[model samples]
Target chain A: MFDTVNLEDARRVIAAAEKKAAAIGQPMNIAVADAGGNLVAHVRMDGAWLGSIDISIKKAYTSRAFDIATKDLATHSQSGNQFFGIHASNNGKIMIFAGGIPLKRDGRVVGAIGVSGGSGEQDHAVAEAGAAAL
Target chain B: MFDTVNLEDARRVIAAAEKKAAAIGQPMNIAVADAGGNLVAHVRMDGAWLGSIDISIKKAYTSRAFDIATKDLATHSQSGNQFFGIHASNNGKIMIFAGGIPLKRDGRVVGAIGVSGGSGEQDHAVAEAGAAAL
Candidate 1:
């Protein structure tokens, strides 16, 4: 059976992401999803952008559902690109942008973390911190 | 200006709900929403049903959007009732069932709490515990 993230793993990832957000002086909404792209946990930091809550959760689903970082997906999802309009799929749950990273174990994707409430670079950085924790 | 639930408040509510769920020996997915129907936080307890995640969040939104317990809403939303088919509205966000309750402060609804993963009665009980904390 494939290993998947659990509540403890999700909390660890979120804690790391929160640290990175604090280091950068940016509050964020962070979400973790298991191998099935189902959310395990989520948090919207105090004063974080309210709109990012859904985006963070959807981003984690997008990453684990596709096993690719959302930053890479954004490239192909641009206009005239291979994945153009793909965001319209999954009932608008696909988020093609930076900030989502798949967590790996034994070189296999086990889960994903998504961060929002900052620029693409900052979000990606925070997600990287979270993924590293896993 | 009307008060709205924040991340801190959301955490407190979730903690109370979690305690109640533990006492009942039922893990659950819990969600809290701000007055604007925006999600503040969510958590899926270990071993909770995956499908309950979305249901919990939507239940919170539905509760805040209508300022009524979903148990009561279900009564009015049944076939041939005044609100029959109301679930078809809100882009599938409305959950016409138990477990969603408005969070009120000084006689005004400030937010809502939702719980899923158990029977309707259990879910409603957990939500009530969360709302009581807020």
Candidate 2:
């Protein structure tokens, strides 16, 4: 059976991330995706621009699809040949950068969460809060 | 506070519709959007062509953004002028067609779900199944 991430879990993750982000005085857009790499939840903070939503989703999608954190993907892409075309191949949704965390339970990836609209370090920190909540 | 649709609700809706479609031997692409018109979930059946994902998402986005079923938007589009350019305006993600249903709870629209990769009528039936589950 496919491992699933449920709503309550996603909400808790998002809430925790939001709290951490608020404490840091950062506004962000967050996105979550299940094991199948489909989106499960998302939020754009009040002051966030609309484009942040797309960036957040792309980061989450890349994390889930590649089964690695997006930061790792960025590193891999830098070492790449075939990976160069991935963004175009995935219809512009696979973003290889920092800001996404793979959600793991029992050493298996269950989903991923991404945060955008802040510096890469801040985004990673917020995403870590979400993953820790999960 | 935002009225959110969780992963459990989205999964149940998608599962119910997938079951119904499988019972009828139909291949489809399904999409779900949260209240804000951003994608919450999507699935493209094995036999479905890749393009169906885009179609399904566009339908769901249109439904959530307009707070009207996609079919109704199609009808409205036919009724005339100002509605014509919406597709272009939304970066080509709005499909005013007969394959999307708004998900409602307590008479308030909670989200929307869409199905494509089949005949419009078939897509509508699958979307209805998803809505019923919600």
Top model by DockQ, which number?
1
Leading candidate by lDDT: 1
Once model 1 is optimally superposed onto the true structure by TM-score, how far is the C-alpha of residue A118 displaced, in angstroms?
A: 1.2
lDDT of 2 by residue, B55-85 (tens): 8878988888888888878876754655866
How many pairs of residues collide in model 2?
0
Minimal lDDT window, size 10, model 1 chain A: A45-54
Error of 1 at A105 (Å): 2.3
The residue pairs that clash in candidate 2, if any, are: none
lDDT of 1: 0.95
Share of real contacts kept by model 2?
0.03
B64-131 in candidate 1: lDDT tens per residue? Answer: 99999999999999998999999999999999999999999899999999899999999999999999
Poorest lDDT segment (10 consecutive residues) of candidate 1 chain B: B1-10
Clashes of each: 0, 0
List model 1 lDDT by residue over A24-111, tens digit each: 9999999999998999999998789988998999999999989999999999999999999989999989999999999999999999
